[model samples]
Target: MTSLKNVQSKSSKSCYVIFCCCTFIFAPLLIGSIIYQSSGIKIPTILSSINATFSVENLIDSPTKIIATIPHIPLESFICDKINISRFPVSSTTQTNDSFDVYRKNVLEKYCDIVPVPRYNWSSPKSYTENDIAFVIFTAAAFFHTRTTAARDTWVSRITNYYFLSATPYPYLPITVVPGAGEDKLSNMKKLFYGLQIIYKQQMNLSPDKQQKWFYIAGCDTFILPHHLLKRLHGLDYRQPIRVGGHWGQHDCPGPNGTKFQAEFPSGGAGFFFSMKLLEILQPHLTNYVENVWPRNSEISDVALSCLSHQLGVPLTKQVGFWAHPPAFTLGENGRDKFHKEPEPNDFHYIKPDEMHALDEFYIYQHMDRLINDRNWSEFTQFMRRFVASHYELLRKKRRECTLPTIEAEVKLSNK
Candidate 1:
């Protein structure tokens, strides 16, 4: 009886040991699985901080890093091959009205009748070289002010409608006028193509040389030309294959504060060169932006591109100019109430027709026998001649210095 009781006790001990071993082996796995499930639950990434920390450089250089770091968001995409850019000069003050439209139409008719050949020794380039270029003009209401106001001597035209046409005239010239549309109509990103298509039709008129090197010029109050523009952004060799319009300055553009006033760049109105490219890209998406969806009121299309850049992870090659003090406007003092004329040691202050001395005026009259009706063209050509005559040596020297990248190299890099 004692032996049987001892054996029962041993059997009970064996069962207890087996249970202990099982608990030790399985406990870690159960706890580990609970911890693993908790870890699998994700916390969303904060974006505004990422935007502030990462810069335009990171976006340009290594976009993937930023893509991984930021939260995923839906982006509107359109296949765009061209970019529409517009230029507004800072001097003119003509508003859009019926009478002004008539005047502009007349200018266009006259411009189309003439050929924009190599007008000046320097105004026309020999060939649209390795870095080919084009211009897209945005005619705002102000450029319609054709008269020579004050001694500023802005907007003079010379119409020789009879004595032109050595070659087939570029059809959209004398003046290429863009019909005005309300900003509300333009704000839709999808429908921007209609305006682009219209521009493309006009550009078809340029000479093959001018066509290859197409550049758009607008009749607005705050335009920046391509020469100064390319210099300001990247070294002239940089591929400005893409750009878009946004806010710029305040003199002609009426706004409390805009990209124009910001001191540091990557802000400011899209200048003339950009308009050409914008037209090219937005045409495909124009129907979408303009027709279906409405444009955002505060967000100008040009400014919207910057936001788009962030969304797409595409880096802007250069930052637009921003203003801190009074803006750098082309129109002389009389054009603006806020304008101040400080001593500009760097500028070549050319003498206007009125500024000339009696002897100088007499000489000009003797030399200027050619008859041209448009004061804007006459004065501008005269200024160009004077500028060239005074600084031709300097300009020629600078031309030699303006080195551009080879097209083959650029193409190779782009492919990579």
Candidate 2:
């Protein structure tokens, strides 16, 4: 019985030794895993490498540094909330293209339901007239002739005053030379500033009676529907210092030391309107703002102007029709063919160009007159719904057929 007691004691001591060894081996690992999960960092590997030197403070601080270096997601509120449509439906069971098409169709239907229809009488001659608004188009010399000529032939006649503003000389067109600014993106910002200066100087020189009521700045590639634009502007009090455009937000600007700054600005593609009064107010401070206050190396003209607008207390009003992206109906083979038709001379064009090459005088006006004059609001909406769905499907198909293969080839080459 005494020998049995001795054996039991030895067995108990062996069990205690195993328990102590297991705790020593796993306690640190368990703690490290908890820390990793909480901090969203790989703490186990780090702890293993620096087990002797690791401390609680180091584990906590490392994640904070990583978080600081990451770029922030842009705020949705900075831009207009009109196009924040519901996400396209997707399911694990379905193919990506099919799911995207379904989503696109759904969104097109929603857009058609809400697009505003013109209430003014189309048959009445008094419904439309040339206004005192001026179009200050920022053009490059390369496409200046083609783009400006297209504008003149298409929509320029609907407005009273318009000029193609460019750095290079276009002796044929009534071009306003904004010297010292180049044709690059950074130069575009400078060009806008200088153009504003010129406009201000002209205003200063003009008799009070002859001063323009509003100034519209747009890219050379932009196609604007003068009648629709005028109708929209007529609703606003131009005498007040107000600005309006297709508002964009949630853009991140890089700052010093791996930081990002959020920005909200109007898209230059859709065009932006500034009341004469607003321009007058901005004119005095334009030089100082551009020279001193504007952020360096910022190439986007819209963003620069937006920053200045923020500082000057001019709020940007968002218009639904002001499209920043290329319109849905203007993509793929059908869209290209559609834009190649000639529009009627008398009717107001509702389509605007988002790119230089999109200006097709022959096709852009195709069925536009009917859409503008013959179709009722409901009919117009339905037409647009069909147009959007068809165009987007072609776009998706093209991307899948052309773009995906190119991307795959690039990936393979990189892998090699």
Tens digits of lDDT, candidate 1, 308-406: 333333334443332212122323332333222321111112222332121122222222321121124665576467545635544554465457776
Worst 10 residues of 1 by lDDT: 157-166
Among these predictions, the greatest lDDT belongs to 2
Model 2 lDDT tens row, 1-416: 44777767665665565555556656766776566467542211111121221112222212211111221111121011223443444566856644534534433333222222222124322322345677888777776546665564445533457777778876555578888888776777777888888877887798887777778888765667664565546467667887877635646644446566665677776778888888877777777756766665776777777666665677787754565444444323224333333221212122333232233331233334334434456745754675566456545544543433333334444554
Report lDDT (Cα) of residue 272, candidate 1: 30
Give candidate 1's total backbone clashes. Answer: 62
Alpha-carbon error at 172 in model 1, in Å? 13
- Give stretches of model 1 more than 4 Å off: 1-143, 146-193, 204-208, 212-219, 223-227, 233-240, 244-272, 275-279, 294-299, 305-314, 319-325, 328-416
For each of the candidates, the C-alpha root-mean-square deviation to the true structure, in angstroms, is: 28.8, 23.9
